[model samples]
Target: MFIAAYVLTGCMHQPEPVVTPIQQLNTERYMGTWYEIVRMPTSFQRDMSHATASYRLNADGTFEVVNRGFNTRKGEWKTAVGKAKPIDGMPAGFSVSFQWPFSGGYYIAELGSNYEYAVIVSDSHDYFWLLAREPRLPRWLIDRTLARAHEWGFDIEQMIETKH
Candidate 1:
């Protein structure tokens, strides 16, 4: 009796395994007040103070994000509202598209266990934010958060410590 051995070959072309997307945020709990502790500088908020963000979930299944800051130079409050949506399968991450259909990646990389603080990031990693429930965070918390940010590949030096 003669026995033959067969070899099996697998295709080299295989679809990349998809990363499990971030968790979708519970808008209700996410709503309320958030103070800016630090963020990547942007023209829109070049000169601002008392910076705060307020969110309200609309019945239409969208969040009404109101960003407010006091312009020291202008001596007035600046406010803007932009629609936000999840980027494909990213749950905790979203794309805040101020101009319809034009979106920018906004990812929530870390959040405080108590929902008092959160770290937001952009796809480019150039944009980042340290947000808290109050204008100032506890020293220990700030230090801990900063350490985590550094570990997460953020340029801690670039983070602008906000007054408000």
Candidate 2:
């Protein structure tokens, strides 16, 4: 009886699994300046204000990613240049790393039909961002994105609203 009870309790307390939708990323449409409207907090971006990311296709078939932001703590601007390459055998899937050799996932989970906004996810789904060309996105679109994120097992409440 004790063993059965313990097994049942463990099963009941099992964590929910994460599910992600198959991403259909259009590379041409995705290359542009994206204002970071919202994001998940990370150590690299801590104390950052007015953050933005830009992507451009390089002649050598790699992506040049530029991340810029103002460090409120340091009272100066911070910039980082990174290179990105598509994950093997995955369409529109990419991995990015900064000056260091280590890399991180850069999956384009959802993109606007008109290239107006994009939702990106990391391999673990712990990091996420909603980016757009302009700082202000339409309310309806934001709602739609949140709904989609929920469907994909992401906790939308964790999203941090950014000023830029």
Q: Which stretches of candidate 1 lie over 4 Å from their true place?
A: 1-24
Alpha carbon lDDT of each predicted model: 0.63, 0.67
Worst 10 residues of 1 by lDDT: 1-10
RMSD of each: 15.0, 11.0
C-alpha lDDT of candidate 1 relative to the true structure: 0.63
lDDT of 2 by residue, 101-143 (tens): 4566666667777888778776555667788888879888888
Going through the candidates in the order shown, the clash numbers are: 1, 0
Candidate that would win on lDDT: 2
Looking at model 2, residue 92 earns an lDDT score of 57
Query: What's the lDDT of the predicted structure labeled candidate 2?
Result: 0.67
